[model samples]
Target: MQNSTRKRQKEELNYLRDKVQSLEKELETKRHQLMASKGEDKENKAVRVQLRGSRARAMRWQRIAKHQLVEKQRAEMQNLQLKESLMDQIKLARSLQKLLKKNASKKVEGTEAAQLQARLEFGNYCSAASEDSLYESLLRDMDAVYAEVDTVCARHPVMQNMEEGSDVSSLLEGETDALSLEATNSKVVPFGMEETCAAVWRCLSKDHVKLADGTYHSVASSPDCIRAKAITTLRVNTTTARMQMRFAMKKYVEPGRVVITLESASESEGPRDLLHGLKMMQRAWVVIRPVPFEPEDNEFDGDLPSEETIIQLCMRLTPSVSATVLDIPGQRAGAITELLLAAVHRNLGWLFQTVENILMEHDFGATLL
Candidate 1:
């Protein structure tokens, strides 16, 4: 009886030890599952925060794009309205010219009207073949014109004051703006640089030029000024094709200041595109100084903040009418000069468009009527 009782006690003790071990294993598994669930919750929170940030950026960009589109449309509408107004003014001028001619007793009035009419004429029309010599001549004497520009600035300019030691060459080495334009073509491959410079000088000098060897040569000067920031434009009867002009340009910039000089130089086929009543052998130098941009207190001032810019433009051009109907094959003309003028029109307009933009107003001073 004592042996049987001892055996039963030993079995009971072994069962209690096995039960304790199994309970400990189950408790450890529950702890591990709680830790994993916490880790997954943290990861999900980070993803939600990132999604909110991305959405805010997208909303900001959309607002900016919408604003820009509205501004562009408003600018285009203003341009169209101005064009129509100019056309009306031109028609009125034509009617006045006719009325003056018909009145037999108005001799003085008729003569004055004729001179004004001649001035209003788009350009000196001529055959493409004929203007070649003039274009070449203008190119040959281009630099002489700028030489006069230097002299004029030196001899107490009537309008703007010139700083000491200021010269065209100094303007050439201007600080560059790398971010404004992604790609640029500044190379003049067709004609040599020497000729273009010469033409510019000649364009400026309406008088006789003393050659390098001390001899004087005469140049018939058609000196004209183009203001890069002119608010007005000239009206012409020509079509859009006349807007094409071929030229080379060099630009320089500094803080609040810019200098742009361009000359008529062809890139392909030696300016053969001139056969179509387009401007050739053109040259211009423009200087712009930025002023404070501020808002005005008027109903007309809401298009944009009125930014004041002081601009000075010096230019020379000779336009010849084309008698030939032969079209230029893939002619890339008039964009650079046109866009350059338009961009700068705080003071000016085309080669045709710019011509219209800047050459509109005249007091008949030094202009041969």
Candidate 2:
């Protein structure tokens, strides 16, 4: 019995040793797993902190951008307000200066009017002395135009219609019909030379009749002839008489420059209104030239011609009404001259504006031959 009991105790002791070994192995695995879990937790915490830092930077930059935008808008508003203030001040200063100038010129303007009132005789508007002066001035203008045309023509393959300016001048000198042949106002419109010339020609040549009332009312016209380099016809009917008018145009080209010259088609013929013993004649050396592209900054206080076309109008009117029209006791010669000049100027303005409007509306293409 004693031996059997010793063997069983030995077996129990071996079983106990095996259980202790298995328990040690399990504890080692659990320790390794715990260390790995701590390492993973440390990595996860680092990732979370990095994400928060990035979000903070994003929010800061967004705020900075918004502030900058507000500041830029404020600056623009202030700049615009400053510009408006400056403009207002400039306008006020100009108004005051014009008022002062008008006040200063009033006296001289009165004296000038009085002197002009005593100029001519009973039945005549222009004196014989003015004829020589007018002829000379027109000749000068014609000479300038001829020289320009001849210069361009010499280089041209086809010699365009060549006429001597002197021939026209001599013919004009002999005509008893010229009431006044003088240089009139011109305009420099911002447009192409050829286009504007063509427009002007079209306006003059078309059988367009308009009746205007002013100094001498009821002037109606139907173009029976047009003589610009591009030829057509228009006949005029007025209260005073019937007018047979013709125009001629010539175009010349040079490097970067275009010139158009318009004059009477027939030297022997002039536009007239048949009032008893009054034969009205008009002679013109109107020129249209393109201005070179450049800045015109000359201190000479007037208008500067730098770009686009130069428009010179050569239409005028002679009073065929009774001599009593100017014989009113209170009538100043300045008033008569102003009235006549204003009428001519108004017509010219309307003509130009009409052409410009047509061009804009109809897309009027330039037709040059």
Candidate 3:
């Protein structure tokens, strides 16, 4: 019994040792697992920090982009305002320059009229003397006046039709007849020059008409032959048969036309009734367009010359009467025609000089041209 007891105790002691070894192995495995879990936790913390930094960088860039876009828009708006301001200044300057030029022209015209009046008085004195020398002197003075008139009329660049050796009277005769016959419609009166000669004036009727501003009145000798008595700031009476009209100027529009567009026809007409034999004046407008010079007639300076650069100045008289009434080229029409011709004759040189000066002085003029 003692031997059996000892063998059993030995077996129990071996089993106890095996149990302890198994427990030691399990504890080592648990230690290794805890160490690995701690390392994973540290790695997770670093990943979270890196993600925060990246987000901050992205947010910074987004703010910068937004700021830049705002600044860009502000600069664009400022630039646009500056451009508009510059354009306004340019227009104002141009208008001021034109006003100054017009004033100067008026002064020059007044001086010229005085001199012409003096010369006429002198001529009359010479003719009244009835002596050979006096008569000769008067004749010479009259010739000089004619020469002056001719010289003035001949100098226009637009007078290309006259240079073709055609007489001005002949050119006007047929056109004038047509104008006289068709007084109801509007017309285009062309002033053409051939080469370096005189301008050929031709009046031809057309359909389209622009308008002129300001109220005007007319006194006619007869309804059949209407005559202009009073124009704006200019009046002519029976006592003074002298026809002196001025202050007409052409404002050029682009594409070879100068347009003077007045208010609508209804607004331009005067009162219907007048004392004596007179008719109320109606609307009027003037148009000047460049007609191309014929190739044969053009004076070339290495540039293409068309009649359009040469010109046609037209005056359209819009009477209040309709197709039912009588219409013919009248004295009023003649007066307007004379006024335009004379005004241009006097002012063309001045106009050209002013334009040239403006072109030289300002970049705007060059750019516009």
Question: Highest TM-score among the candidates is held by which one?
Answer: 2
Assess every candidate by TM-score: 0.27, 0.33, 0.20
Q: List where candidate 1 sits over 4 angstroms from the true fold.
A: 1-145, 150-244, 251-258, 265-279, 290-308, 321-369
Better of 1 and 2 by TM-score: 2
For every model in order, what is the number of clashing pairs? Answer: 32, 18, 19
Error of 3 at 315 (Å): 2.0
* C-alpha root-mean-square deviation, each candidate: 35.6, 41.8, 43.2
Query: Per-residue alpha-carbon lDDT of model 1 for 251-332, expressed as tens digits?
Result: 4444544455555422111244422333233455555444344345345755644333334455433222222212334232
lDDT (Cα, 0-100) at 217 in candidate 1: 24
- The CA lDDT at 343 in model 2 is 35
Ranked by TM-score, top first = 2, 1, 3
lDDT string for model 3 (153-233, tens) is: 343322324221111110111211111100111112232222101111110111111112112232222211122222221
Residue 198 lDDT in candidate 2: 67
Instruction: List model 2 lDDT by residue over 262-297, tens digit each.
Output: 433111122222122222333343456665555544
